[model samples]
Target chain A: MARLEETTADGRTLMRQTPASAEAQTANATLARKMRRRGEESRFWWLVPTIYIIFLMLPIYWLVNMSFKTNQEILGAFSLWPRNPTIANYMVIFTDPSWYKGYINSIIYVVMNTVISVTVALPAAYAFSRYRFLGDKHLFFWLLTNRMAPPAVFALPFFQLYSAFGLIDTHIAVALAHCLFNVPLAVWILEGFMSGVPKEIDETAYIDGYSFPRFFLRIFMPLIASGIGVACFFCFMFSWVELLIARTLTTTAAKPIAAIMTRTVSASGLDWGVLAAAGVLTILPGALVIWFVRNYIAKGFALGRV
Target chain B: MERTWNNKAWFMVLPVLLLVAFSAIIPLMTVVNYSVQDTFGNNDFFWAGSEWFDEILHSDRFWEAMGRNLVFSAIILIIEIPLGIFIALNMPKKGWGVPVCLVLMALPLLIPWNVVGTIWQVFGRVDIGLLGYSLRALGFNYNYVNDPFDAWITVIVMDVWHWTSLVVLLCYAGLVSIPDAYYQAAKIDGASRWAIFRYIQLPKMNRVLLIAVLLRFMDSFMIYTEPFVVTGGGPGNTTTFLSIDLVKLAIGEFNLGEAAAMSIVYFLIIMLLSWVFYTVMTAYDAEQ
Candidate 1:
């Protein structure tokens, strides 16, 4: 299923030669390319993934198409595209305080959670990667056990705890609450990336009269920039996408857009167009983040485990 | 890489330890506390002493829900794993197609879980949805809201649409990292296509596939929002997995003690299964 591209035909025949040394590595590459190029599998195989992608996009496309149509057009017929496209649904979200505030509220807590998770996770991850502290293995595994804990189990407890602290209906409450799941994940991923960096760098930095904090900030932090980006992206994605805990923890003031969406089924009826617009809008922030980190999606997100 | 034995590293980890404790540990303790005590409204409580646990274990409802959760997770893993590997294997190795595929494939994943549920809900409506309308036009009685079989199919397909990208991404990462020399040596040996995949690709993909399977298993086991939004655990409780049942018990019916007992047992089941998976896979990896 892998695609191989040949830049030139010059090395095609040399690919048949038996490998002997460093040059053999290039010959090996050439042979691999030839195997791929000479395979009888038709290019029609590409259609499998293309068709799969199209299938994946169809529902999302429907969501986007519905967002552009009036509610009448949506319920009136199953049109593949909007007969008359209008941005009225989007206009509703932009103009209404309740609608737009959901976005702001979601962003505020998501960014807060991402920052808090990554920040606390950074030092913890470094410690795990660089040292075998007391109960390190057990502590590491216990952190992961939190990741496996269903939010359903914590939904009521979290509400009670946060309310006791008078943090109910607040963004920080949701942010801090999300740290339960995100912090463990951040630590795990970051530790994987940090372990890939040799210990010699830390020793050398210390020898140069750099204090631990300064050396960690100047040398280690930059070294794992991609890992941090990946970790932040994951933390952002989880915090942003999470609904049950966020819904339980907040009421009106800090309600997430996902929970706000439930209100679409009001006294009148379901606002399919407006709800679709909100759904499409939710995809935007994540899409923008993914675009910036697309280059790292394949590498950093693998967490160096693969 | 060797790690130094420095107990002082705990200082660096203190902040996370405190944060997770506040978030995870305390709430967990509350669940534990509630599990052993029966409470009535107005903050009145009585000692129950494992009564909730005994009742939950003996209850047919809890057992039924556990059975449903297991069946759902098993089916999801069976379908998603092979399909994810196939899709990943088929993906373009390089060029512009790579980024385009990655972005479009990941779109479903980035959408909120509830939104995914909502999308499927609307998309499966016979009156307004494309899939429902098309299926009706093709002369199949495909109503998700009212039919048990249809509801199961809709929920499973929704999960697949939502999560298959995660497996694909992980497998693709494993695929790209394979050095060209491995494939070259396979070619030099005149290995057949199946032989190449079995001997070269699958082994290289072991670690990522392990992560994919474990994540998918745990997440599928605890699934709530998407199916909850779609089916509301309806069609005569056919879709009511453990989380859905637990929520109904705790929040809807206010059976806090039994719910808490069920929660601990549910969590143990996940942890035990995950440990087994991790141990078995790592042991196999070691032998390999």
Candidate 2:
């Protein structure tokens, strides 16, 4: 029987060795202390990531500072922070239809894309992880190739296809369009996570007389909850930030925030403060998503092997 | 873990297949159709056959853009991968710092591509932007608009700032998954710092690093909006990457057939290179 226990360096079985020898116990304690000391020695290296993060945040900080100031103030002076900080830029975005509607349109499509990608991916990922079929490797590779295809290559064709189907300027159009890339990604990541689960779990569930859907939803899903979260986060992130296809597929009704921002450079010139505020608002949803999925984000990055 | 042979698995994958086919295949076929036919107006297309392909093949402009793309991807990979790894290695293994670092690092990745371009475009402006203003104040002649060298550096630096966090996040994920037991084993064996990284961390990080390299390569190769917003491929055609050039030709000039041919060629190059990288990396991964 394979007991659920982690073995030590010695040949003795960890679960059975309840009364371990004093020598072995002492050795284990000292080994742990050594590891702790090593961790302490490396603790000061935290400064490296700190400095690097400061470098990363400086440009963003400048943007936030600029957003709070008037356009004249932004162009006239180079202050570190806004001397006369104002929320008028944000007010302009909140009051404007073209601006705020961009957020609504972006959210609708991104959510739809996330749900669709993750739902379709779960079954396919389970299939890839637990079973083999005809042309499985080819199918998997082909799906990934879609991920590699540049959005620019598809821009014209996508415009034509969506317009032909009369999907132009609709949320579902961009939502379905993003599936080209997101579905493959969701499948790949979820497959990695699923492969980490033992096949015996599925077999055990089946032997218990549970149907596949019940087993998957009630048992397998909760097990790989982080994986699902990671997949959804990625799908959301990709769909949310993508502008080329969204720009191509939408004219007015579903123009994304990113596309709307581009129109800020009008005949009058760029609206620096308002544009910065919109940029800041655009970052908000992703930031919120990242915060919610922070743990899974790291686990997801590890491809859920851990 | 051996997967069982089950033809019935097709049922599980059907939805994905249908969805992807609708989004991918139809459009790809259309691109193919356009590639072989020359369209003028009124939906009139002449049988151009391979003439457009031959023209694109012979065009010096296409070759130049391809060359620029290759150099840009190479430079980005060389810089971001190592820097990302180094940052990940030094990151706090545990504590409040982890979430703070991860979130802050991820801020750039979440920003839309065009906004990222705008941030740098404004940030690098001598009149209002902090970076350009500070540099000029320090008596340096820095301008991304007129100077090709400055444009290249700004673009490279902007990309590094934007995407290194991705590599860093991936590497950090790999780093954390490594059991403390491995570090303990290395410590007990009196391993040096370099040996610990060489035999343990580096090998552990190989999978995520493979992903980082491939993603960064493909994305950087397809880069358009950022440079387009900042330089407008400016000061001349110094930064007009293949995608931007294709867009200009197809949309701006309306040479649909020639642009479609160029797109196909561009797609083929990416596909072939990605296949090579994937096979080589995954093969090496399996070996270890």
Candidate 3:
């Protein structure tokens, strides 16, 4: 897959005089070439994938390996794989109300945030892609600026703002806080997808006497279904994995799994097994999400619209 | 067409504008307010008039944190971008290996930020963790908890492991977009490997590279969760970046004015850099 050659047309004159030296050099070159070609043809393909897989799997293997062992085992043993695997740690996380509720809270806010961001971003992206109005360029750039705003800087302001509005500890506050970044990203990605659709389609629909809403819903929406899926997936991923803003915005009722996980470590000691179990569980939803969206991620980027 | 151009199109965007304004503008105003005033509980406030800004601007602590953030971002970019591209180059463009490779690369990106920190925190212990235990068994003294250098290395390595995949995925998308004709052309021209990458692939990947660079820079600069989870910005503020320090000042210490000033400064820095990136990328795109 990665091969290159350099052409030297003028080398024919030099090649004629250096046949003796060239014959020996060519013999060695041919031998080296044969060896290299053999390497590529035989095991090179397998080697590439194997290295990548091992690189990717090591940390996850370590996490799962620790999760199966007892805390004492984790502290005392250094096994590559668990010797006597146990499910006691998994039970701790699944059975405990505090831990379980964290997952529920995380889902609630992430779904809410994703829904809000995608719904809002759809029209905005459409407008930016299709219309050239006053300040449209400026507005589009301004939206992207929000995506660049650091969540840490907004933490204090978000907390104070939510608290003042009596929205602290509510799922809405967390959802709203996430929109600061998610909505902008949704708009950007969706806008790219939307722009790729020819404007003549909209013009054709208008010539046929179709209204704006009807044209958008009937024609434009179906054309960009995959784009919407891609945008929603990104919105879900960012909102799902984010911690700093979610932690700052919620205290009790809406605490995400991330905040709950942080509490697992205490002055007494780290709960290695339970923590690993929680970590395992934390990755499950994202795994499922990426699986569902896996096909679209590459395809979406392949369009080169975003 | 003229009728479609009416202001009713503005209504299409109204929901987003309202949502963003409520979420972003209101809090921004609050930060602006706090940056210029002193608050002493029970809603009591006194006019400080840029004193907080002046203090933050002049403080060695702020400068140090800024320096650390810049260095961390630079290191992450240096490691991630090329490594990601190299990995992408090796990735399978066909067959079952494609999905397997992609899913594996995405595994780290799936884990929540704090959990990532926790994973490393446990994974780095000399007594209990595999990494620590194995390294110790192999005759290395590495202890991230106490050694400042180890702590920095641990944090940087952890981040690279987590985020480099994002760049890989982005670059892979760019790579796959190139037409087969380009490769055929290169082959016919007898182009050298370096020439192909320099003249063809690199130029084609520019758009995605721009996106990758900007996203990575912004995220690295704003990094808080992983380091906070692993080190708690500890061993005496060695890993304390601007975000961690802002949280400590605002929530931990309850110094609203100073925190607010710091946040504004933080926001400005991010905004300025992002604007520069956007302008440069867009201008380059236009030129192309």
For model 2, the DockQ equals 0.56
Each candidate's clash count: 0, 0, 0
Candidate 2 clashing pairs? none
What is the DockQ score, from 0 to 1, of model 3?
0.41
lDDT of 2 by residue, A1-306 (tens): 011112321223342354368786667667756765665465577688888989998888888888999988998877999999999999999999988999999999999999999999999999999999999987987887888888888888888999899989999999999999999989988987787689999999999999999999999998878788889998998898888889889999999999988877643456899988988888888888788877556455434433
Fnat values, one per model, are 0.68, 0.67, 0.53
Query: TM-score for model 3?
Result: 0.90
Query: How high a TM-score does candidate 2 get?
Result: 0.93
Give the best candidate by TM-score. 1
- Residues B1-288, model 2: lDDT tens digits: 788899999999999999999999998888889889986699998898999899999999999999999999999999999999999888876678888888999889888888899889989999999999999999999999999999999999999999999899888877776765677688889987778889998998888888788889988999988998889888799999988998888778878888889889988887887687668766885786
List, for all models, the DockQ compared with the true complex.
0.59, 0.56, 0.41
Query: What residue pairs clash in candidate 3, if any at all?
Result: none
List the per-model TM-score of the A chain.
0.89, 0.88, 0.82
The structural similarity of chain B in model 2 to the true chain B, as TM-score, is 0.95
Task: Give the alpha-carbon lDDT of every model.
Answer: 0.86, 0.85, 0.80
State the C-alpha RMSD over the true interface residues for candidate 3, after superposing those residues: 8.2
